[model samples]
Target: MTWPLQRLTAPDPATYSPRQQAIHDQIASGPRGGVRGPLAVWLHRPELAARAQDLGRYCRYDSSLDQRLSELAILVTGRVFGSEYEWQIHKGHALKAGLEPAIIEAIRCNRRPDFADVETEVVHDVAFAAHRTRDLDDALYARAREVLGEQRLVDLVGLLGYYTLISLTINIFRVPPLDGGAAELSDV
Candidate 1:
């Protein structure tokens, strides 16, 4: 299937306004190593880019949930939104963080993944439910709270919320995956 032309490409760095240059440099210097994808698209609004990237840094790096759990939540968010760029970007991170490959595939195909522990399962459940329903019902919320504890649960929700914004940006702008390959999310 063909994708629509990307609505916004990164502005030429040499032509960047001072504000853009500053934000671009900051983003490039951070853990992301470089700016591309949704972050790049956001560079058009330097203030938005700067603020969002700061939140993104916290969500991606310093959240209370460990890398494995964070990546799991990110994958679920990407899949639920059918954000191809988001999915392809984080699939590698999820694997490197030690989430099972089968679980990743299951999420891509919209199937129930068999998680090995209650923590993983609870994180998945919270992400899936929150995305599908737009709000958590009482029991699942209680379960997630109980399983993830207060701080982790809060961070999990914040992480999910952050990725949701990322997904929206990717989808709205028709952002293609960075790999520039055929789309990987079939059932999404």
Candidate 2:
């Protein structure tokens, strides 16, 4: 796949610096079990890659939020950023995690998804508000806290911040989809 920018190169395991090599091994052995996407881009600076991989592991695998809510925040972040690579990476995971096709499609199209319950809608609202306005409004804050509880609310913020970082790396590096897929989103 052709990337928007040609300045960066993907990291090769064979050619990695010692620091990169160790980081690569850690990630390859962890839940992700392979290094790619933003991880590859960040490998240019092995230190950055190591720290990012640590945080990424926690956010993606060990978060307080369940898989469904985690995937929702990820997909919403992808949509908000138009991060095709991000969307392509998580859409299937979201579906497998039991996010409805209709809700996923709505988010893919940048519309409000018809959530099956208030909790899912609250997750969406919190994610969307964070991306769209830089902060959540008071009512939604109360709703998210009321529905998700304090721990989940904190995890939601962490998820949002992590995905924002993911989107930024994907967009700035012009990371291609894992499948080398073509563009899947455009300005509406």
Candidate 3:
């Protein structure tokens, strides 16, 4: 499905104030090139923007979970939430992390993907649990703990919460899904 581009009414970046430019620069160097809609909103509020950038940095760069699991959790959450923007952005990252196309497609369709191994399964379970409940049952907790240590497990939960927040914001704002100029959601 094509998504519309939600054009910002803000002034052009070339004419931005020094503070705005700084925020823009921080986003540019951060994950997803800081061009994401949510981050763009944060930029309009400088203090919040800085804090958001720092959180983004920690989640994207300093998280204890490895890249593959991180991407898995993100993709699963995006898929479950039907946040097309998030799905569009992370699908490529998921692919690059060696996730199979079939698996990605499965996730996009909200199915239980066939994981290559146990680690991916753990990530998937955690994501499912996060969406399905606030508390993890004993079985789920044990499996996660067995696969990922306490620290990494906590980080995994944090990642889930972070992306869940992102999904909520983007969906609430109706952030347009990415379009390569073919068909716009606005036209649909």
What's the true lDDT of residue 187 in model 2? Answer: 40
- What does the lDDT read for residue 114 in candidate 1? 96
lDDT of 3: 0.75
1 against 3, candidate with superior TM-score = 1
Candidate 3 clashes between residue pairs 3 or more apart in a chain or in different chains: none
1-188: candidate 3 lDDT, tens digit per residue: 44445544334677777998888887787556645666776566777777767876787679997787788899888877777777777777888888778877777666788877988888888888888887789998998999988998888888888888788867776666655423211221
- Give the alpha-carbon lDDT of every model: 0.92, 0.87, 0.75
**Residue-by-residue lDDT tens digits, candidate 1, 37-149:** 99999998899999999999999999899999999999999998999888888999999999999999999989999988999999999999999998899999999989999
Residue 125's lDDT in candidate 2: 94
Best by TM-score: 1
The CA lDDT at 141 in model 1 is: 93
Regions of candidate 3 where Cα sits further than 4 Å from its true position: 1-17, 180-188
List, residue by residue over 36-73, the lDDT tens digit for candidate 2: 88888888888888888888888889989999999999
Q: Distance from true position, residue 32, model 1, in Å?
A: 0.5
> Is 2 or 3 the stronger prediction by TM-score?
2
TM-score of each: 0.96, 0.94, 0.84
Ranking by TM-score: 1, 2, 3
lDDT for model 2, please.
0.87
